[model samples]
Target chain A: MTKKNKSALSEHTGISSPEITSSNAIETLKAKRKARIDTNTLVSSILNKNIAALSRAITLVESENHKHLEQANTIIKACLPHANKSIRIGITGVPGVGKSTFIEAFGKHLTSQGKRIAILAIDPTSSITKGSILGDKTRMETLAKDENAFIRPSASGTSLGGVARKTRESIILCEAAGFDVILIETLGVGQSETTVHSMIDFFLLLKLAGAGDELQGIKRGIIEMADAIAINKADGENLKQAKLAKVEFNRALHLYPPKPSQWSPKVMLCSALQNEGIKDIWKLILEYKTKTTENNYFETNRTKQNKFWLIQTIENELKRSFFNKKEIKEALEAQLKLIETNKTTPFAAADYLLSLNKSLQ
Target chain B: MTKKNKSALSEHTGISSPEITSSNAIETLKAKRKARIDTNTLVSSILNKNIAALSRAITLVESENHKHLEQANTIIKACLPHANKSIRIGITGVPGVGKSTFIEAFGKHLTSQGKRIAILAIDPTSSITKGSILGDKTRMETLAKDENAFIRPSASGTSLGGVARKTRESIILCEAAGFDVILIETLGVGQSETTVHSMIDFFLLLKLAGAGDELQGIKRGIIEMADAIAINKADGENLKQAKLAKVEFNRALHLYPPKPSQWSPKVMLCSALQNEGIKDIWKLILEYKTKTTENNYFETNRTKQNKFWLIQTIENELKRSFFNKKEIKEALEAQLKLIETNKTTPFAAADYLLSLNKSLQ
Candidate 1:
């Protein structure tokens, strides 16, 4: 059998089945036919809010096989029309900043308000473990059991770029599956925050009050990218400190030039454990949505982001193809050594290497 | 004459002299031969601290003529062995922050210490005006006349990439001319500050006292890139306010993560008019240099910067070539319209556009 057919068959079986009797082969062929039909049916099922189909479609999008890629593209094409109808929010904080608890509380609040919520994560570190850090259903017990909420862990082990692409595609599947709100979670330590920030309409950074190292929870540029900051765990003894932290963050935000979005970033206090101040944070998101929608920044920003990702993808592909060239790879180390020794300028070396690429001619 | 010869002749004449009789042509040919010999002479003159040779070489590097690029590259190749011997400092501040006066005072101070200083500016705004805002000799009258100081305004307006390339090349020529101190000035209002930051060994931000809008003078990322912050105009009534600002800025810097270079950025107060604290600022730079050099960060940082520029130039060139394709240009607007209307995904559009470029295949 061809490799493609073998992979396609294995895709449905979830295992590589060796050759068997003619009857088993016939059954395998039947399953392959059914999988083809399932692609279209999956779209209709997703549109009707079939959770199982939505999950399977997301799996297909995350698959590395060529056949799965083609199927995923078709699924995405069908889902595209229904996507972008949800409010996507990216939540991030350091590991101990109660991100999961805050998200669980926040997700439950949204569901209680009659909004269907889908929670996703883009954890770069999870790729190495082959299991998502946020995927443990026990961490979000209440939300995990809620019929109105769907929680997904970060896609299993892949490059950040690969993981980011899968999560973004999964967003389309979730939106088409009738989720009205999407919550994207990322660890504050890595570049995942920036990727999550770009894909979401609102970026919410969660910080701990009086950590004494308040800025330590988030990366340097991440604060500047935030649409709003929440000092999480602001209950009990931490109340006064949280309030002061809010004021301090507000002052720091003011020091930054106004965002091009024309809406000033805000600071708020919240306690996920107490389930306090949750509604106020949602209200802030609503107000931001209103202001940005009125100013047309909401749609324009998405369009700009789309274009940015498009060009970025192209650039990445071009660079990959260029560097993957065997000849160029062999020459690069020597050329870099020349640059290090100051025997040749960077521009001159770049010119020489580019001249070596046959495709440029 | 061929275009190459025509341009080569124009390089020496500074104009296109119309065709002449044999006798006049012989004289022109002699001058052209002399110009060919002058290329090597220019290298020797620059190595001998001939200011005129350095100036002319910089102009050649900045020229638009294709012919001059070859000549400039030749001169740069010869100078490579003599470069990388200077301590390059990048200074930036907003328009009303008294950048010119501060630089003038700083330049004079360096010259007084028996240091030959070469000052260059990277003004993005000047590119649109086709004349450099800082190029006026009158702006730094004293420094312009100082025998130990060579002050050149921003190169005639070009794209930021073009201007940055020219300035970087000019640094090589300046260093070859035995200028041990180089100060690169950039207007704080644009992306030019980041460009200047990447190319220099140390970055200094100059501000004013009692400005109320202290952060208003620079972009969000610029402060994080600074090696030290200097509050200028600190003498007179502004002294008290300047000291307060210094403390505030110190607190702010402490909030940032430690730089990879392992040197803590410092904040100081200075007054250009009174020339107070000028020496102290220099001392700070010297201290930073000693610390970084001992840690080997200075050399490593320069090497990293070289590799960065090399890759960046390749990326930019690849993007330029791809986008400049006539067919791609024609299709881009329509594809952008599709994206704006959400009729297609950015990934799908990028794939389609990449396929259109025959070179990719």
Candidate 2:
């Protein structure tokens, strides 16, 4: 404890103090436990308006590290009471549809009206490189810098299609942190749009107006899931084409039955670059909410969506586990070979493989 | 001494030879073991100019007794070498499309051509009533008595949509038995049509012309899968409309990509009831086969189909076993509760439940 003793200890240990290694080890242990505790506490604190804690909690939830998941779950649970306040809107379109630019314009317009906004970019498309995320933020500089607007570029290292569960859970955390409106931006990976739609209150599909031939490749089921179709970049020379495309979409919409929510999806045109029709888009969403809520479709839809997620998640997990089984690994290979050779019917082979798994159990 | 003993035994048993209970028990045991051996042999023997075995095998395959499936498999395997020679065709349409009557007409035509034929009715709509199968055969009495033709009704105690797997396997058996063509008749359930399509070399979708509203509910995907769309009941007053529908289908076929085999799926008009266009209808299926086989599409498709069954079978088994777990029972219940309460994301709850499954060794 004396100065002379401390110097001797530092010199002998080569660590400035003999207790440094042990203390550092202790500190590391404490930090991990603290992180775990903080996740849940941060969730609660952020629910009470603590921004720093909320950021940490969302980070934990999005992490791929196995240890982080439980802490993330606890945090999500703590934040649950304060969540579900905001209107969660999911926006998706093909790669070149100017989604970030539209979000920037859309967010600014909302903030101008004194509305607080949270932009949660759930990019399930490609990996989020540092350069790309920065580029995305740079494009939305105006909205990014606004005090009333919170823009979070998607967190890194998760499944493509934007770590569906994390993005969904993060929405709750963001809403609990008091952002009145939540915007979820999804990439136009054919299937990710469906995942995003399942989580959000409103799903808006953006399209680039073009010939009908181009529309054939996109899956019809996805087009039917959209609550509203906005033909982006609708100004300038493309204006007439955009209008025609809108008409086409409206005709297509007629072929589909009304959604279970009883919402008659709308098709509109907008030039996100010129910030044209941004206000009308917002107004339409509000009207949708009002109509659906009046009909009690909003609450019912959200509940049904929740149930769908649960079943989907369980089914996916079951599939993953079955494929992962060691015994099943060999049995499947053999069964597949037999199947390829046409020695057995698929149902019979399936029964045989399944019986093997059951026996093991 | 042997004659005296035989007389005493017969007298004591109160029978011409053996005791009735002992005789019945031996017969049951023998039947069970035979059933376990594979039913194909019986089908092959019966179909390959052996009427007795074919009838016996069909009965065995249709038996509700657990031992029959084994016998069926055995008989079928024995019959396999004879199966691949026939052209398999699937026929399906809504009720009153005159399915039974059409088959009668078609069967008679084939028999007249000196071509042996076999028909298996797969009717999910009609339960296995005491007379339903026999009734279909009775309706086609003239065809049924033809030495060159065979007609089997839908089996009871199996999933609807057609003759069960054993029945399909039996088709191959019948073909090997020297039947040049096999026709699968399915009840007009729209969805079930897809199941039948996967197994057949050519799929014939029978539709009543001008059934517009009903057609809308029938998915376009299924229509796209059809190799030939036949506007059936095209005789008399319906003839003109049937032709128009056939033309419309031809146009629709143009929209789909050239099938992978480069086979141009044909659309045609026919009246199974009036026997109108029956010969042309068979000609179309034959032409399709010839064209596809010339391009090697026919063999390639069969291989692909076999592979599909293998993977599909394994996947189903995995699903069944995973869901059957005791832990999943609790996990599912818990997740359902969370889903109901909106406490967890469906994806997250699914991941958690799946993680609880015994880790693959």
Candidate 3:
């Protein structure tokens, strides 16, 4: 009847597709909505110790989208009260120093003690190598598989400051989700270590004994910042050399004045692959925590770190806003040329540029 | 015209005050006005190699008055084209390291060769100690008396950034005054060394031979930054220890990777008090200048330093403007407390404060 009645111009449907609005599709839609949970539900779920929710929140924090920034801030602010409960440990070393193996073993030791752990990273060079530090989850198979362990790769971006900010926020989320130990791993070769050091309670620098028994790249500033240095691969034939390296580092560590925290940095030997000395390293960290806590350095250091981030965030944003402006970018190059040619002093150029920016504002 | 007549309402003036606009007083006023020269006159007089004008210009550069900032900027910009013609050397040592003796000896050596010299200082701790590095020009008595040398104390300010900026601007004034060599002296024990290092072509660390031979404070980052380490007080009874220190510093210097300058840092034994090895130290600096110039690192490094100052100035000014705001000051304290109580995340608080700043702008 429809074919006959619907002559040339008439339009008619033969049958409505039943599966278009089926119960499974509705349930699937509901699931999709559940998966894309809003900030409040995400916060609640994270507080409820949901790993999926925590992961999603971190992804939101690491996102590059401007729209996600608001949601990320909302989630992070909601989680702030639950944060700052964990001891953030920063572990760093050169690429071949067995960082992954060491971290895996170290993290496993923590989980075995019934401690929930989260590992994050801020590889300053990750923007190029895309995070050689923890880019490969397979590197820490046992740890990643543990229900109590959450491993996050470095936040991929061009600026170390941006990546650092992301990782810092992620630490808050991890702590909010009841992680007792937050391990931040970074490459010791760059500016990231300083950033990692500022955000962490204990900084552990991993080193390897050279063939001549000298430590590699003593990295003066990083070593000065370290709470403890562990000579990795201190097993088998490397034991004697490792001991020598430890002594050398011990002497080098003495070169720095007492830290503001008044805690003397220590040097120890460790074999990550052989799982030797891992316990001793952890014990040293525990000892550090105990002493620093007793002396009130732990809480005071946290307060200092809090204030540092507050100022650092403001300064970074201020510069970012100033430099990201199209007019400022063009004017900056011209001003630099002026400086190079000695036509303008740096301060005068800065003043001129700032005046330009003020107009822009 | 007497007092009785004035009392009677005659309004007669007493005999005119004879000294009121006398030729001698008028000439004195003229001299005072001449001493407080304008920026153009300051620049021209400095370019003419007048020490008095150079000193006045530097004083203007270091002035804390807001109005002086503009005048100082004008003088610096005018002097800039005449700058970059001299080698800027930074000399630093701990308080007890015989810094004054070494600098005086080194400076005398330069002046003896008919090379005019200018010494500036940036003691970061100066605001408290009022510049212990070069606070008293009497410390460099002979050099200060030398016709070919000029010495200025550290610019006094609470912020190292402010002091650094003032010293940096004064470098232009000194260079314009036809100084053949500029020596920037800073205390090695604090952050001033880094500030001085960033502003100079050559960084010389003055070390002392200790009671034993072990190098004092091996000073990792500074040692890495040094172009040469001169073990001062290396004569008489300390010669053997100084020899040992030289060897030790030489070994320690090798621990650092090659610098971008491509010139290896050297360690030498010197006795400034005895005037021993002063010529050799000067020769070493000449060699460094020659090598770096040939490699183009000299020019490129200056270019990099120029850019660093440009960005650093803008960033510093941005923070200064923001934090100095009355609203920002109050909001910052409130935000800090909120952060302490975990009522807000740093980045979120940063956004809120930044937005607050934006609205004011």
CA lDDT of each prediction against the hidden true structure: 0.85, 0.73, 0.85
C-alpha RMSD between model 1 and the true structure = 8.1
DockQ list for all candidates: 0.47, 0.45, 0.54
Per-prediction backbone clash count: 1, 24, 0
Task: Please give the distance, in angstroms, between residue B113's alpha carbon in candidate 2 and its true position after superposition.
Answer: 3.0
List the candidate 3 regions with Cα displacement exceeding 4 Å. A1-37, A130-132, A211-218, A254-266, B1-37, B130-132, B211-220
- Model 2: per-residue lDDT, tens digit, B236-353? 9888888888787787678777778676777777777767888998888888889889988887787676666555555555565567777787778888788678776666676776
lDDT string for model 3 (B294-323, tens) is 999998898888788889989999999999
Which model, 2 or 3, shows the larger lDDT? Answer: 3
Tens-digit lDDT string for candidate 1 (B298-324): 999999988888887777777877888
Model 1: DockQ against the native?
0.47
The numbered model that scores best in TM-score is 3
Task: Assess the local accuracy of residue A339 in candidate 2 as a C-alpha lDDT between 0 and 100.
Answer: 58
Residue B66 error for model 2, in Å? 4.7
